[model samples]
Target chain A: MIQRPITVLMLSGLVLILLIGVTPAAAHGVEITYALTPVQTVRVEVIVHDLAGEPVRKADVTVFTPEVAPGDAPAAAEAELSPWLETSTDRNGWVSFVPDPALAGSWQIAVAVDDADAHITLPLAEESGLIRLASDQGISVMSSGLQVTVAATPITTIQVALHAQFDTGEAMDEAQVVVYAPDNPQDPFLTGTCDAEGRYAFAVDLGRPGVWEIQVRKAGHGDWLKIDLDENAIEFEEVPVDTAGDADSTNTTVQTVRLADEVARSVESDDGLSSGQIVLMSATTIWGFVGTALYFSRRRAATRPESESDN
Target chain B: MPRRFVTLVLIVLLLSSALIALAQAATGTLEFYANGEDFVRQGFVSKDGWAISFDHVYVNLTGITAYQSDPPYEPADEDAELVFDVEAILEGSYLVDLAEGDEDADPLLVGEVDAPEGFYNALSWEMVPVEDEESDMDGYTLLIIGTAEKDGEVIDFTLGIEQSYTYTCGEYVGDERKGILEADDYADLEMTFHFDHVFGDGELPPDDGLNETAPGFAPFAALAEDGVLVTDLAALEEQLSEDDWTLLVDILPTLGHVGEGHCHATLLDDVGETAE
Candidate 1:
């Protein structure tokens, strides 16, 4: 694996499950007590990527841990948050933080780049030697569900082939596909179904150059993609050109498609599946990826209580 | 041994579930903002080739609420009701100026509320006429004061609208995911306005969906006098051609959005009934 230089905010926030070493002769002789020491080292990894599954590197990452009153942590409502760590993402657009076992509470991370900002909150705590993350702050490490990945490939100047599939590498067969033209959003310009390979190819008349959207839905999940046709991408046949120069035409219409559960955009291309052909959707325009930051943590097994023999 | 293992597993499950429950029970601040985007803050050209610049654009909004939706909300879904676990409501109307800041300024804040910690994905807001009868902006939900120039002809214009709309939107999709409020942490949700929908963007292909539906500034420029045209939707409806007037009315409700995403804009009449 290639190691990219990403600034890491490692939060060592866990308790190492320790065995209870009790004195065997406590009933007849002197006894001793033990403290519940926090020794578990839990690491939370935050991955910030774009729709293309490419990492958004060099972005500034600011971590704000909830304020605790020394031994008496205030209630969530009365707590005032202060920045616990400030760092920038590495080349992989990721940061790693180990929760402060002493500070066992929620942590808020703000990753910013340019005009885009992604805030991810993870309620991390080291309790009873078990480290658990917030319910679901864009982290679904358990489910083997479908994750839709939309890729565009131009078949012709006006025609494009859009591919949709789960990150599990299964094609979204028979999924409903709806295309809405840039201007007429209320009505569908074209509607079709994906093949067994999750590919839906369609063609249209190039009357003008603008953004086009394709919404793909399967079962209860939905995902969408935006194709920006620029001047160099199409041949306009007797249509009025934009008089505002190329400045305004750069980003015509912005379409953001977030599906129901875990709106998956993680495209794992390791299975020989090609990815990031979105440039085929736009010639001059760059769809800057300002996406969600995923917070993930791997918990260790809890140690067994002391056996009777140890006592 | 199997029974003991099952009991231990059950206890762990209960403990973890309780921790998750405690995490979800926390509360946070959810900030709401109104953004005209660069299209209004910096101005743009109308589809008909008019370079426009704004001085002030005021909008009256009420019934602002955010929802923590499950199965998520899709505005494009027909008759889709927001199945939310919690809804954070800002219980008051507010008058906001979209063009109140510089080109690089942040969006204007509408208000903030103590909301449950969750992904407040879907949002809803209503645009009503200004309630103050004595103010110049009264009786209007939208007021636009701008200058449009095309082909050496300049027109100083103020477009006012008494029409009202209630926009129901899904999760905000833009440079980032919004409305994810952590305990004691704040997240922002925005109401984005696409003015290009009204006057058509001059920087796009003339046949683009947005420009095709918009009547552009050409029709409004025709209503100018002595390089000035200040009028309301009612006056423009009388002066503009039937097609242009109809298109203007169709575009006004669509002016509200959640970032680049569109909302289900329901036009309401004077009696707050859904207009035909």
Candidate 2:
């Protein structure tokens, strides 16, 4: 009986080991957190994660402080004087930065995983004096860094693949990607979830040849990236000229404005009756009155003569 | 009383009643007919000495009116409300295709109107293009399919024109041209459209003015035959130059001759009418 229990325990442990081996790792991403202390000093924290949700240790974090106010035209500042503050994440995937307590304007923080190509802009509000996330698509709050491209076209079949990443160049998993076709665009053509390596793909047969728009988004993110594709070309910019016919057909809405004003004005100005018209009008009126007078007089003459002859 | 006095009184009363009846208002059917019905059926010779026949001619005849006053009947103000007491003829789009010679297709209805029985000095018509989305047929405002042949050399031409024509009889009145509306009667306002005038002398633009070979119009033949054509206002505006487009729009309405396009009102009982 004891041997049987021991065998059952061994099998259970083996099944647990197999389960752990099969489970996917967390998606590669970055997270930044910040809080203000009672002393009015601000401390910013940065955390990096691998695809398996494990901490990514020793990633470099760079911080840029702005000389002007937040929400102002970035170009008007002319130059940023503050030197970049740099540090690396510790063993627990955490990095800390302390700004001068007297300096209280906006600050732009950036994180670089390894090389300068993989950099992300961390979210910080200049006025709120609080560190907040600008985007939730990946570790970085800025989603504008994502690059999208189409496969190929003449589009017998529609297929699109997206690589989700932060501005810092870290791959992001679990991001939502949706594809929309020209026809039935109100509904999604297909929806996909990113794999461990921060990649999502979709494919379907399309019926029409026109512009197809795809949207990529992450949870808690307000805005998403939009990509357009033409059936005849791999890129939207290379769309064929003949495809504009569909656009021509759609611009046929009825223009309710009357189209004859200019012609009427010209006719009126050139040949419309002026003084002669008045004479004709007077003639018509006089003739009408004359006819009435003649009728009344003839009736009176005939009636008077008849009455006189009878008397 | 003497018989002579009684007869005189009766005669006077009869004369007054007749005068009153003649002065009273009357209603009639204002009929519109094209002059080239027979020519459309049988091929007619063009001015270029070529035989030509039309396959279709569609026009939207709307906003018909008759004015009792003289010419220069206050230039039409599109935005102005209907203040002048003008007698309206047609209320909706009236289609007159000479090719469709069936019983149901003859004598297109202008409208049923009630007006004083007299001569209306001015008659006006507003002909706008047929829009595709609003119409069941092909969006061609005017589609003319014909063949011109000279010396055994044949040229098949198809022209689609989309333009709005607003014209009044003021400029077209001859010494005796007038429209008469009688009580419960049928009258034919014959507005004859001369296709020859459109392609007159086969000259190009700035020469013949409104010809098939005009810059914006020549492309219509090929596009229509290919079964991919839309001649809406915007399309024409885009295709034609400013001068050519303006020239075509200005000259098209003056194509009909006065007598050919004048009104000829007839009594309903005079002939048994065969109209739909």
Candidate 3:
């Protein structure tokens, strides 16, 4: 056999070098991180992560909002300097900001991750005055359940539309709807009942801009629901409801689909869904993250340790 | 156990004793005052009657003396008679009468009088009024004298008269029924009568009139001034032997006076000592 010492030496050297180099590389993985420059200035948060689904730390980052040019090409706009970027992340790899005179519109958080780059855009919108109520199946329902809304201006008048149904899911006409002052449950300001379509409309002069509660009950059934004026599932509009008939009809429901279409068409003539869109988008984003985190954590735990080792 | 019972008994006894002592202490005392003074001494009546005589002869002392027959029958006779001129002191109107004890004896007047209206006579043969006015000492002294005789010779003699008076105390002044010689409101009177005389008689009358012929006298009349007399010297001696005049003097203010409108007499026992 030819002398194998040289070959063995070469192999040992290669193995030793590989072990020495890979240890540091594995310990220092590519990470992408960004943080607000000033601390606690506005209600803004910055997040960064790597492709491996791990929080990226110590990443030089920049932020921009997307703008449209005349050529129909996307261009980067100079970010309006946020007032709340005075702090960096701690050892926990987290950063937060509360922008003074907070920024409006979309905020682009871009990160440089160990020679690789990624970005996230958070569409910042003003707080919504909208509230929605739906049945258990995720379809919006108007069947004897409560909905509430808050207003941006000092409220002068309040309009309430209700649809009541019985235990058999049949429309319950002539159900009494009483609007009470929120703090005092006994003083009912308005009393009315549903029509043949299980729909009731009440007009109330709120006297002042404040929270109120509406109570709906079928004449014979004990089940009733209360809707607070400032709850999350309703929309408060300053415009007259007749001006937004189509939107109102779309957002509202009666016993029949034909009636719902009529109502929507009536509400469509007014302003678009202005206040309700912000609240809906926020709710969607929050629920998306919550569902994603829950699924990721549960799926990670349920996978076998042997399967992960093989990967 | 016995000790406790004894203690209980002792406590009960102590309580009862204290209650008894408290009850006894609740009794009050009675004090008697004579007039306004506290001292009352010897008090009594004089000895004498309304008349006096010497035999059946009537004699007169034309110049305090008289002449009579031979050597054995000396003219200077020490046995003389005395009579009390009782009428001169009778300021209140009264009646008088005379009667003889026998045929040989001279007829004598011995009767009572009617006391004047609204007046009380102290000296009268009878009819003693409630009070005597003339005897009241407004710087006046009453002197009465008399004499008696039998067949031109001095024979058996008697001199007697009653000195009576009225007295008053507060609102009680006189008794209308009794003459002046009888004190009215007699329970309030304190009086004393004194007599001074010389008698050649054999024996004096008893002071309290225990012996016959010696009229017993009421030594002290509490209210009415009846003929309260001391008939003999022995009784007077017995009363005055002790120095009890201070007690009588102390009682004088309460007893007050009868006729004199003051103390009737200072020497209360002397009246009973010289009775005949």
Candidate 4:
């Protein structure tokens, strides 16, 4: 009876002490959670803390998500001092992001607080409450019966990429892709055909902030994503490179195999003429015109004297 | 000198002169003008002892054509066999405000046309309600806003007429003689819009001339008295009976000057000199 009483008292005391220590641990860890919305927007949140178990305010958190198809290995998540959708933790050590459809994927959030970095990849589970991870690969075949995904980045020119596959799990290429504002459905603001890779990547200048829809169709099946735009959605804060700390102090990287190599290689032929190539082409054409004009003028001048002498 | 060289030099000079002349005679300009006459507001005396004054007079004028006659016309001949070839002129509606007497304003110059250089003898124009999608002016071509006073009572009238009339050279020949156009000339034709003709008598609506059976001016006149003011077209339509609206429609064409181009043209003799 005496042993039992003493053991119960010691166990109760240890439990009380652990509960008291848990409060500090909770405030000292930077935790991030996110939801990959079916509407093609990524909702991300980050809770940051200091070593002393205090909420670290304004800690820079850079989230990088390399867009990859289902079953493909994500590229190495390098420590980017200026990631795409970056934000700072508030007084509650919390920061969130509902990234635009252009930035939807398995986002790797890299948090740097007090020269220490932490990373997390969302969504955390195959079937989280917000993201329905139906595939071992992070492929979300939406309930709209379209096996396609949309990804975007908050750049001056929003780069949107569409990855589509047929019901037979084959890449659907040369699909008819149309993007337009809902209010102006008749005017297909952007219309193009998907390449042989079942990928259509294009840059659009979102002149105004409003909801836009993308429609991708192959055969008779189609996929759509409603993109919401706002001031917070189109802008990002770059992560600061802490020159005062160790260079490799917070070089944390996290990646998830998102899509298959077959899907990724299918869109390998998507490279088109770059802006520099276009400029070079225009210059060459102009020089060719000048050279042709000079040659013809010289020939005409040389022939004029012979004609004059004959006359 | 060789005959061939002389012939070649003459041919070059002749060809150059002919080309220059053809280039010079390529186009002729016609300027339109409005004549409010003595029947304008503030000074006009109606036949029925009422002192008449017009505020606004809007007329839709169209189908203005210049004609090439085989022989020139006599203004006062008893019988003249006149044949004319129609030349295209300006076609548009113009608001002729009797009160807007500014010479440099747009109201003064109704329209202007650039035509090919040719001798034009007869001018024909129609004062008609617009029947085209180009304008909303229909039924009555002219809208006359005026006030008449006799004794102590004042009558404010919005006289509407839906009549369409084509006035050729004969209708405009009397009094003011026009219908001659010179090549490379700028013709300035002054159209006379007589407000006195609208109201035959000083009567609120003249009793005669305007047919009253189907639709005419007499019924519109019966709708008003010597003291009431009719404001706008909507107000007039609201105040008048349905039959009176039909009468207004019938009388609209007959309200203003049927001979729209009651004019005299100042033909240009030289490039800058005007033949008065």
Best of the candidates, TM-score: 1
TM-score-wise, the better of 1 and 2 is: 1
Q: Which stretches of candidate 2 lie over 4 Å from their true place?
A: A1-311, B1-29, B34-51, B71-86, B102-112, B129-140, B148-158, B171-178, B182-187, B201-250, B255-276
Q: Is the docking of candidate 3 incorrect, acceptable, medium or high quality?
A: incorrect
- lDDT string for model 1 (B1-276, tens) is 445445555655565556544544467899999999898889999888999999999999999999876545667555457777678999899999999989988999999998777667689999999878798798999999999998899899998999999998876755455777767889999998888888888777886556788889999898899999989988887898999888988778778878755677888988799985
Between candidates 1 and 3, the one scoring higher on TM-score is 1
DockQ, model 3, C-alpha based: 0.00
TM-score of chain A of 4: 0.28
- Can you tell me which runs of candidate 3 are displaced by over 4 Å? A1-156, A208-211, A233-311, B1-276
lDDT of 2 by residue, A1-311 (tens): 23355333322221100000001111111221111111112344556655455665766554444443343323222353223344566787666544433244455444445432133333333332222333333344322322111111111232334455543444555655454454544344444445556655443343444333333334211112222223121221211112221112222221121112211121111122334654565456545655665566667767987899899
Clashes of 2: 13
Cα error of candidate 3 at position B269, Å? 99
Ranking by TM-score: 1, 4, 2, 3
Per-model TM-score versus the true fold: 0.49, 0.32, 0.15, 0.33
Off by over 4 Å in 1: A1-311, B1-25
CA displacement after TM-score superposition, residue A96 of candidate 3 (Å): 50
lDDT of 4 at A57: 77
Model 1: docking quality category: incorrect
The interface root-mean-square deviation of each model, in the order shown, is: 29.8, 25.9, 76.9, 35.8
